[model samples]
Target chain A: MGFLSEDAVATFVDVLVRLVETAGAVIIFSGCVIAFVRFLVLAVRERRVSSFTRVRLDLGRMLALGLEFQLASDVLRTAVAPTLREIAELAAVAAIRTALNFFLAREIREEREEIARDTAERDTAQRDTAQAAG
Target chain B: MTDAVRDVVALGVVAAGLLSGAAVALVTRAPLAGLQWLLDFLLAAGLLRLGATGTPTALATAAAIVAVRQVAGLGLRRARAALAVPAPEPPAPSP
Candidate 1:
């Protein structure tokens, strides 16, 4: 192959940066979409419709963590070179966020189930007591 | 301003919106069933834009992002409910 000129090198670097930015954005968007779908399904099944209060608290904490991770990634991506460094940061951030979502989902599910069961038991006890008195 | 300062400014703006969203969710008891992902996406976009160039525009952009997310989340939750499948029952234990 012929030697590349300085102008060609600059053009190539610009295109590469654009490509990285596009890819990173797409990855983040798609991953978040999937996580959201999962959250919706889990929340419905868990019957946490009345427990938004708890989730709101959880979200506040989660948002803080998510923000810290995302900001750190942005800082690294902007401050570092070599391109791949930014990609690595993106991957790491996505993975961490996904893991956190999963953990939160599981916790919500367990707590909701416990609440449902307790409500059910209390209702059943009330019914039995009324029947005995009658 | 330097890139570092710009990044910090952006982060602060995005953080403020995020905190506001979280506060709204907590205080208003809005549904969280499908908002987490939307919020995360908004937060990410906000951080990216605000961090890139420090400006008042960044604050407006972040607010718009969160607003869009709130709308999308309501639609997503409804759609999800309509499309839900019945979960299978667990096997019964031995007597």
Candidate 2:
């Protein structure tokens, strides 16, 4: 019945937990917004033309990378806090995520190069075929 | 020591060791793609560290700076190549 009741302390802790959760969410949201803006700026600077098809590809890749970045940041902040055990767990997760990104980036670059090479070969083949037909 | 400093030093040593190994591999004409794996690990650690600290805006800004540096480097190389090459004559018209 006193001011020092256990219930009061429990309620206070609950409120503190909620505040921390809310702050974490806000951090992630702000990260996403920043990523979107950066994407827009890069697209413009790159002089990218916006065909529906091309735009879709560009947005997908950029957003995927951005979100990956955001997640990576979240995992990092986990370790930075005072929970040593949680830090170890999160560090493992971060390592896996990084490996995934590395492989994905390499695949993307390789595919892009392959596509360019194929396009050039196809063009040469078409020209040869057209010349023979004529 | 701070995690950041520890990571940087670790990565630097790894990079240096890999470079030396790569040089040895080059002499032996062996594949050296494993160096790239180390780089990938460092990149992941760096991105996570960046994410842990400041706001998303700061991370985005850093990413933008990296992209700009890459584009500028490419453009410079292209311009240099252009200057080095003679312009090709117009294709001869079909007889």
Candidate 3:
């Protein structure tokens, strides 16, 4: 049996990084498409623009997840950065992506909280009405 | 540390973040605020460590991101709140 060479290992890592990057891009694209379709369906059925909030939250969550993958790719690229210039470029890219991820995550959290609160209030109102009738 | 090992560690940190985010998203009813806090700390620590030992640039980048995100989040929340509020009613017609 032949053993793998050091060059082969390096090549494998390179391939893996590229694959991860591609996967991240694909996730963002697919997630956005799915969210848009869902939003359209709900809006058409409900005839209310406010229905978009739910879909927007869902999409934001997906985008945040995709941003994680992108940041990972950026970190992986640092491994091969031989020059200061390349490293600087990676830093800039990472900074922008991370900032985007942070806001996206925060937005998703706030939206989720709002939705939960609305549900709780509605449940309480219904319970009160039932008690009054009884 | 060798570049390979460093890369592996960075990848692991990111993978953990992804998993934690997914977990938070899936469990709807429970308040997983603690998990969210933990995730933020973990990512911050990981990035800082990488920057300190392997690349200082990573730390700077992460710090800038954190600052920008905080400001942006505040602005967005304010905008959304404003939109949620109804406009003032028009004055009653004078006889």
Candidate 4:
């Protein structure tokens, strides 16, 4: 492709940043919506409130990923010619988002470990039962 | 660096970070603890470079984010470990 002019390049970067930010928001929102819908459907069909942890874990993972994108876009927004005040604002926003992402990640990890442990325990119990029956 | 070059590099880094995140999500079944750290490091480096070129904001932002993440992650890991440890059993009923 032909080279873009300086102004065009700057505008392109600005658009890209906005696009990424929007996409991040969409990902997070859609993740939550989808997870909720899935849970509702399951609950209705099964007549039980199962799979809550799975849904929450999936949603948390999506939110963490989306937050990463949002953070990147925020950083990119100041790439062209950022003023001191803008930088300060960016610092504040980035710090908050980073903290959110960190907690979301930790929660996701804990849930994953819990699920794994449950599965392992179940399998061990089943194996022992089968051996005793045999 | 010139504005065009800088913009290109910044865009490139962001793209790489996104791609890496996606790849990790797709390929890994485990929790993203380790890969997330790598992704954050890459982003911090990219933002630092952007800040060096007259955008001190990017550098400061990156530094603040990384610092918080590291400190919080340490505390979280310790807390998680503590939670995982089984509580000591109470002494047997009095004789």
Candidate 5:
């Protein structure tokens, strides 16, 4: 309807941005906590880099998700642009986040490749052992 | 409200980073690994701070944190690779 005013819409966007950013922070925090626990457990039980890699991989995924959410919030923050300064700030923030996101993605890809290579090596070793034993 | 939440989260993040970093260092016995983990958590904290404050200074700080993390992470990866044991060579063929 025509009932909503411009300030009202701006306020709504502000609220939405805050909600989105908070949600992103919560996701990142919980992911970090989970990864920390996993790291502790793996450290105690296996003490191997392989196990830690999986934990890091999962953590990286979570961070990437959280970063995207925050980036969305950043875009939303300027959805109803008010001033030139605000737009410039948004651009600066977005640029930094985009760069960080790129690196996070690359690290995740590297970890996934490492996990795949490990699995292949393990499977080959198992098959050879089975054949030698039979 | 955001300020309070930011403070609490920042404290929690630092603590988590330290605890996990120590655990990793103990398990791997590698200072580089621990430092890398610590920086990742700190970067998360910086991001959170930026979200809450949305100020230019906060943005700059976040950017700095990310920069340090990338540089440190790369160094740690190289150091670990260098320190890694080489894969065992295949058995020699029959003469």
Candidate 6:
């Protein structure tokens, strides 16, 4: 009859886990769709590598955030299952997701730098052209 | 419900990957960029799949994807350098 009874706790935890995981998936999918639309529009109008890079960068950021949510769900799962096997599974899943997110972060940083360089190059090229013409 | 959601996202990732890959190729005139874009989305799809399932086999496949992606990325960058492709910069020396 108590709110924190075993049945209530199990049901609450299950619902909580599902909610978190669903939120993560929604974030990732929405990010993908937004980036997809932006990429198409920008690709057509600008046809610039920097623009594409920017869109992809935004997508990567979203994916990283979503992964965090998913990893949180994995942790929640561990709370329910304290057995050795479950913990081992959690370790592996968490490790793989962590590694993926790390690489993703690195790639995002690299792309950001590339965008800066590209902008600089464009400015230099324009300046040179103007100087020659003037 | 979980399986359905995962399947849809997985399919969406594939479709996005192909479309974005082609778009990059067409816009940038660089096959390397296209391939890299494709691989990026592929990794996303893999991670999405892994979120629900954590079997040892799934973990191994995920790790393998990361390894392959890194190796292929390095190779592509090197190929760009060797072919004198105008990289935006010197890749910042991979920290």
State which candidate, 2 or 3, has the greater TM-score.
Answer: 3
Q: Write the per-residue lDDT of candidate 1 for residues B49-94, one digit (tens) a residue.
A: 5324234455456546645654565465555556655667898998
Which window of ten consecutive residues has the lowest lDDT sum in model 2 chain A? A47-56
Question: What value does the lDDT take at residue B63 in candidate 4?
Answer: 58
Model 1 chain A worst lDDT window (10 residues): A48-57
Model 3 — TM-score against the truth?
0.57
Angstrom error of the Cα, residue A77, model 1: value is 10
Which residue pairs in candidate 4 have backbone atoms (N, alpha carbon, C) closer than 3 angstroms, thus clashing?
none
Maximum-lDDT candidate: 5
Per-residue CA lDDT of model 2 for A6-123, tens digit only, reads: 6666566545543443343334333333433443454346432222113223322443364365454545355334567556545654554455455446544653664566679889
True contacts kept of 4: 0.00
Write down the lDDT of every candidate, Cα atoms only: 0.48, 0.43, 0.57, 0.59, 0.82, 0.79
The C-alpha stretches of model 1 lying farther than 4 A from their native spots are A1-3, A48-134, B1-39, B47-95
- Model 2: colliding residue pairs: none
Docking class of 3: incorrect
Against the true chain A, what TM-score does chain A of candidate 1 give? 0.42
lDDT per residue for candidate 4 within B1-95, as digits (tens), equals 34465445445544544554444344333234324433443433333343332455665665565566556656646775787699999999997
Report the error of model 6 at residue B71, Å: 3.5
Model 2, residue A31: C-alpha shift (Å):
17
Which residue runs of candidate 2 sit more than 4 Å off their true CA positions?
A1-64, A75-80, B1-95
Between candidates 2 and 6, the lDDT winner: 6
DockQ of all predictions against the true structure, Cα-based = 0.08, 0.03, 0.04, 0.04, 0.52, 0.49
User: What tens digits encode model 2's per-residue C-alpha lDDT throughout B3-90?
Assistant: 3653454355345435433533343343322233223223323343343334445545535533443344345436645875899999
What's each prediction's TM-score? Answer: 0.33, 0.33, 0.57, 0.56, 0.86, 0.84
What's the fnat for candidate 1, on a 0 to 1 scale? 0.08
